[model samples]
Target: MHWISMIGIALAANLDNLGIGVSFGARSTRVPFISNLVIAILSMIAAYLSITLGMVISQYVPSNYANWGGGALIILIGIYAVISDYKSNSKIQNENGITSYIHSPNKADKDNNKVISWKESLTLGVALALNCVVGGFGAGVTGLSPIMTTLFIGLFSLLTVDIGVRAGQQIAKTLIGKWFNLLGGVLLICIGLYEMFV
Candidate 1:
């Protein structure tokens, strides 16, 4: 993948991290620097593996089909994100809960002290990184370098989360967290469509 495309994929892959970060920030939860580092590293690994798998899969199919297939996968992932976000929001409404565990790394408790544990940080990192694997596959099929993609993923994951947390701190009460995922899904779907058509 070209450097520009790698950056795009990385941004899309970690967009959810912004929302997750917002959730953490709104609660005044501290995300340790180490946690950010771990998340970045895990995402890089996931990107490498997914892209390699896509490369392997590309070998078996007609080049045209492979391209469309990659696009289709991205669209499907976007659709899934949109659906999941809607369902999660609805469920939270029904439960009358202040905290949502769906599609987020932050956990809500009755106690005001809401620091995220290191274990939870690792788990969250893994969960968030899973989103990138399929995207890396899409990029891989389109001929992106795994090494460059990994670097982009690591960089974007850290940047997006940091920004999201800060922004969340400013608008935590007013912002609806699900919209972050919703926007990310829309971008993914658009990228997928663009890949298929272009």
Candidate 2:
């Protein structure tokens, strides 16, 4: 039962990753397989860092307070996600003076041409990892065994996120486009609230 609960928590925490993956997929149609793998690896590293940090901090703070703190942080992240979703939903012209739909299939291809250099990929990887770390802190505060829990959660989360990205890429091939970021942002906010308050 305990293991099940841990896996459940890990799965819930991966919602953000799934959303981010979808956004990445929707934005880049030709995402290399290696790139996806790298993203997953970075996400795992982030989970590790977050869990380790949470464990260390747990020693300094009261358990109850730590839980509440985690909840508060999640709520804040939710609010930020909501705002970002709003901004991302707005229409914007690319450097080529083309007004692209957020859900457009060609948007990813167009964006891909903008030059996703290695430096950018590395930066995006770190960003993705940081996001995972934030959620991992909440998982750590739940009193689960850190390393074991992190491993299971990371693996599952990465798998789901990869699938989401691939699916988004495929779907982007059809319609004018979908607001995957907005959808993901909403999920994050909702999940964060649930974790914090419930």
How well does each candidate superpose onto the true structure, as a TM-score? 0.83, 0.62
Model 2 CA deviation exceeding 4 Å by range: 1-34, 91-123, 142-145, 173-179, 182-198
Which one is best on TM-score? 1
Q: Which stretches of candidate 1 lie over 4 Å from their true place?
A: 1-4, 93-104, 108-120
Q: Model 1, range 1-198, lDDT digits (tens) per residue?
A: 355567777888988788888878877787777877887888899999999988887888899887788888878888887897788667754332322342445553223457655555666777777878888898777666888888989999999778877878675777566577787777778878777787
Tens digits of per-residue lDDT for model 2, 1-198 = 246435654664555455545666666534455655565676678777787877787778887776567556655655675676576567553433211222232333334573333444454555555656666776666445777766776676557657766776675466423444445445545545555466
| Model 1, global lDDT | 0.76
| lDDT to native, each model | 0.76, 0.57
- Point out the worst 10-residue segment of candidate 2 by lDDT: 96-105
